[model samples]
Target: MIIHGNRFTLRPDADAAQIEEALESLRNQGRVIPSVKSFVVGRDFGGEYEWGATFMIEDLQGYWEYLVHPAHRNTDQVGLPLVDKFASFDITDDPDPEMGAKIAALHQRRYDSDATLTQLVSDLGEYKGSAAPGAHGER
Candidate 1:
């Protein structure tokens, strides 16, 4: 699975409910939206994390498609008039489970720590799993 960070800024008139509805519709799509094995969009309920809402794309390509796809463009058509509400927009991608882990492990090893790096790596190494790494209280 590939993960893409897609942060959209809605027009000032758009409300949370409308944004929520748009995301819900996308999640139910049968096709025409590939690479998006799973997607989530919504307003923040509580706890930590930035912004009022966020979108998660399972496939970077799928997300790229949606980013330009008419399907999204059409729905967002209604929301576009309200776009000014947002302060910024952002999107990022990380490859599926296995590779992302190795990449993070490397980063954590290199930039995360030196004195603690060995111990941290060892602790993570203790886990025996084939799947990609999990979120570690990340943003």
Candidate 2:
């Protein structure tokens, strides 16, 4: 299983409605995305980021499904612009030593296929993770 996590801080100008909408969209991802085995989206109590979410998937293929799903892309469109900082991580029990590279490749492929996604990520104040732009040899 792989546990994918994201944490983000909203821009100070973000209004309540936008925040709620983003949160609701995040919640909807777990419900609408079939590849998500389990998930949680909520406020970060003591973390540096304002909100966080975690998604559990059975394997790399499931993770790819989760990433490419329409619902997930919609969430990114709705939520990415409102956030000033964002970071993501993955913890997996898969035994393959190449799993990390494979995961990063999936993300890179997603970005390569969508110019809007690449721009959305570029607009962020900060983004960090193994699959982040420029990370793991990504341009």
| TM per prediction | 0.38, 0.95
Query: Residue by residue across 1-139, what tens digits does model 2's lDDT show?
Result: 9999999999999999999998999999899888898899998888799999999999988999999998898889989999998988899999999988888888988888999999999999989885587646344
11-80: candidate 1 lDDT, tens digit per residue: 4455879766665554443245654555555543453322233345554345445455555544444433
Question: Local error of candidate 2 at 45, Å?
Answer: 2.6
Error of 1 at 81 (Å): 1.4
TM-score of candidate 2 relative to the true fold? 0.95
The per-candidate count of clashes, in order, stands at 7, 0
Output the lDDT of residue 76, model 1: 43
RMSD of every candidate to native, in Å, equals 14.1, 1.4
lDDT scores of the candidates, listed in order? 0.40, 0.89
For model 1, the run of ten residues with the poorest summed lDDT: 124-133
